[model samples]
Target: MIRHILLIKFLATADTAQIKHLQTLFEAMPQKVTGVLTVEWGVNNSPEYRNKGYTHSVLMTFADEAGRQNYLPHPEHLALKQVLRPLLDDIIVFDFQL
Candidate 1:
């Protein structure tokens, strides 16, 4: 299995509604793409305040490396990126085997 993580920093102009819309889009991925086992989203709520401006996170679990690779170029993912790009100041993607 693979654990895929995304740390997101949205632009100041991005509103709550837009953020929620993005979350909705992300939540739909498992149903739209094969081998996507699960998708989880969350907002930063740490008391330590060490998020470095990243306010949201998306965590995806894939069945295998092929699943992760497949997700990279999937049409649904491309569409999601189109919706996400304009709202972001920056993003960090990290993955690890599990």
Candidate 2:
């Protein structure tokens, strides 16, 4: 199995509505594309100081490395990244085969 995890940090002025929309779009990707075992997304609502800067995370599970590769360039995935790129300060992607 393969896991694709994305951690994103946004500038405070970033469009919250658009962020939510992108989260929803990404969460639905497993249903739209092949080889996805599971997908999840969440916003940082914790009032804790730990993630004082970073705001959101997306965790995706794939059947294998090939599944993750397939997911990467999928049209919908690209579209979501386009929607998010402008608002984000930084994005970190981690993939591991388990």
Candidate 3:
């Protein structure tokens, strides 16, 4: 399996409603993408407070690189990015075989 991890820092102006909307859009991805095996997301809860501004984390599992590749430009994913990209201050992504 391929584990894809994402960390996001929202812009200060994002506001609660916008963030919630983004989360809702993200939650809908599994239904839109057949290659997605699992999708889990939440606020960063580390006590260390050393996240460097990243406020949320999303973990997704895919069957392999091909599945991940298919997801990258999938229409639903692209549409979600159009909404999310502008609201983000920074984003970190890491993918690995598991």
Candidate 4:
């Protein structure tokens, strides 16, 4: 399995509503894509740090690389990104072979 992790830092315009919408979009992927085993998204609830205002994240799990490859350009994902990119300040993506 592969775990595709995306850590996101939001811009000022990205508010609670945007995060909720993004989470909703991501939650749909597991059923929509063939190899997706799990899909999750959320805001940071950790109280340990100052947060640096870095707020949102998505963790996508797949059976393998091919499953991940298909997910990258999935139309629903693309459409969500159209809303995502403009509101995000920074994004870091990591793929772990598990």
Cα RMSD (angstroms) for every candidate in the order listed: 0.6, 1.8, 0.9, 1.5
Candidate number of the best lDDT: 1
**What are the per-residue Cα lDDT tens digits for candidate 3 across 1-98?**
89999999999999999888888888887788877888888998899999999999989998888889889999999998999998999999999998
- What are the runs in model 4 whose C-alpha is more than 4 Å off? none
Ranking by lDDT: 1, 3, 4, 2
lDDT of 4 by residue, 1-98 (tens): 99988889988877888778878888988888878889888778998976676777789999999998888888877888898888889998999998
Identify the superior model by TM-score, candidate 2 or candidate 4: 4
Which regions in candidate 2 have their CA more than 4 angstroms from the true location? 45-48
lDDT of 2 by residue, 10-81 (tens): 877787688788878887888898888898888778877787477789889999877778988899878887
Distance from true location, Cα of 76 in model 1, Å: 0.4
lDDT of 1 by residue, 48-88 (tens): 99999999999999999889889999999999999999999
* C-alpha local distance difference test of each model: 0.95, 0.84, 0.90, 0.85
> What clash count goes with each model?
0, 0, 0, 0
Worst 10 residues of 1 by lDDT: 26-35
Clashing pairs in 3: none
Global local distance difference test of model 1: 0.95
Give candidate 1's total backbone clashes.
0
Best by TM-score: 1
At residue 96, candidate 1 shows an lDDT of 93
